[model samples]
Target: MPILEDLKEYVERATGLRRPGKRKVSDLARARKPHAVRFKDDGLVPNHPRWPLIIYRGAFEFDERHDPAAVIEDLFEANGWGDTWRDGIYDYVHYHSRIHEVLGIARGKGRVRFGGKKGRIFTLKAGDVAVLPAGTGHQCLSADDDFLVVGAYPPAGTYDECTTIEDRPRALMPIPKVPPPRKDPVYGTSGPLSKLWKKAK
Candidate 1:
């Protein structure tokens, strides 16, 4: 089946099969892998933006019988995130100044640094997911041979690359204009991000 067709079914099954009050994505993941999340505070990077860098652990535990990357990608798309792609993390330092980003670690493991050189570092493996707010820099410190990431942005999240503060003034203006997705990419409408992001300046 085509990806769109599969996406259609995924959306229907997810929305149609939901209970009155439950996160379908979380419930779905619970049936496969144990899913978890973490929220970060304002780091070296500065923005009045309302979202945090979300990390979802065991977001897509894959088995020989199940493809986690594909599942993660689908979930993201169904949640109004788009511009999906798959690749290893870029070795050089870079950040998207125009839009936020989400990265799903589909296979293998790696160390990634976020928020420029002064930022924090994280270890990501298969089933891990990281949601990066705009203007935060990141780079792959190291990785295993099979490391793969599925990345995306919210609907129409056209992006640009920035390596330093030179991009800040131009970058900051759009931050407030970027609206949050109706549903959290990993969780659903009632997720923490829904509340935190609304509080963003």
Candidate 2:
């Protein structure tokens, strides 16, 4: 079923049907302080030491007239995050050792575990966005059948998936070195991310 879903997404993307908007628009619903959480290196998942994962609740808004997923993709693109994709989170625990990631909930709700086995679990709904620093483990625990998420990466680092204890040793060196995203996916240069990340550094 996952493979078939992947194929359907591929076809939609290839035909440019997945994104129907060609113009830039501002649809941010509200501005609020982001909820930041830090997870320690849980032995297996070398969570970032300096940066805390950021969660922006109800960061964007859409109505029946608009396509929420496309709006999320456009916002990320406008803020300099690229390599956008539309899909559900991987069901198993995993992480990116070399790059940071941002996920914007587009159409449904889900329970996701952040960090590793000892990490926290959060419920994410449409309009919510989560920004993950490199080495931060995450997994989708459960979701509604209509759940959809839009993901993107900052331009600064290489994307690498690490899921085993065997990958831990090599993952350490790059976890702290990965550059912070130039702009927050939800806000531009002046966003809280710029200040918070710089302060952490």
Candidate 3:
């Protein structure tokens, strides 16, 4: 009960701030692929796939009067990770290409949209487990009540530099068009994206 209370407290605190008017994604969209921080031999590439970003799920509870931010920080530390606060909105349109994430919902309900394509959404509820593949664009939608989610990332420190986007409300940027993957005997499977395709294939 304490865990749940604590989680509830956090959500309340996070939502206490002024609720900005909802901004829907524009009908006319341009191409803009999601990007995550990556370390490469030739600097960081914004549009590469990094897969298998694993995370350990943990138990949590909610507290109406508890500090959600502090509780989240504590949870991350206990699990050997650090917490960084960006603009405080439960729902967001962002993607981490280098890491896969596991989300454990402790309380309440919410929805997550993966990929740049609209109309595709994943919903979450108490005791539900969702695995988010890397390089996929996602955003949380409709946090009706307080909800707690534990996310796990792979490749260590991949989340150290998470980019938070602000000023765009309820609108998704278009996915950028990129060159197709190479197919030939000369260009054998290599690099992060190639590895992900091989594993998924």
TM-score of each: 0.74, 0.89, 0.41
Q: Each model's C-alpha lDDT?
A: 0.66, 0.86, 0.38
Model 2: which residue pairs collide? none
> Rank order by lDDT, top first?
2, 1, 3
Candidate 2 on 127-179: residue-level lDDT in tens?
99999999999999999998989899999999999999999999999999998
What clash pairs does model 1 have? 50-200
Candidate 1 lDDT over 99-188, as tens digits, reads: 778898877899998766666788999888877776666899999987878888887457887666576667767755666667767765
- Candidate 1, after superposition: displacement of residue 124 in Å? 0.8
- Cα displacement (angstroms), candidate 1, residue 45, comes to 5.2
Q: lDDT for model 1, on a 0 to 1 scale?
A: 0.66
lDDT of residue 193 for candidate 1: 58
Choose the strongest candidate by lDDT. 2
Whole-model alpha-carbon lDDT for candidate 3: 0.38
In model 3, which runs have C-alpha deviations exceeding 4 angstroms? 1-90, 155-157, 160-198
Q: Pick the candidate with the highest TM-score.
A: 2
Model 3 sits at a Cα RMSD from the real structure of 15.7
Worst 10-residue lDDT window for candidate 3 reads 20-29
In terms of TM-score, which candidate is stronger, 1 or 2?
A: 2
RMSD (Å) of each candidate, 1 decimal = 6.8, 2.6, 15.7
Q: Give the residue spans of candidate 1 off by over 4 A.
A: 1-27, 31-50
Q: Could you give candidate 3's per-residue lDDT for residues 1-201 as a string of tens digits?
A: 446655544664477432111121111112222122222111122222433222222223435543433334343333333332322123555655434444556456677654433425656565443444444455687764566554543334244222344312211121122222332111113323334334532
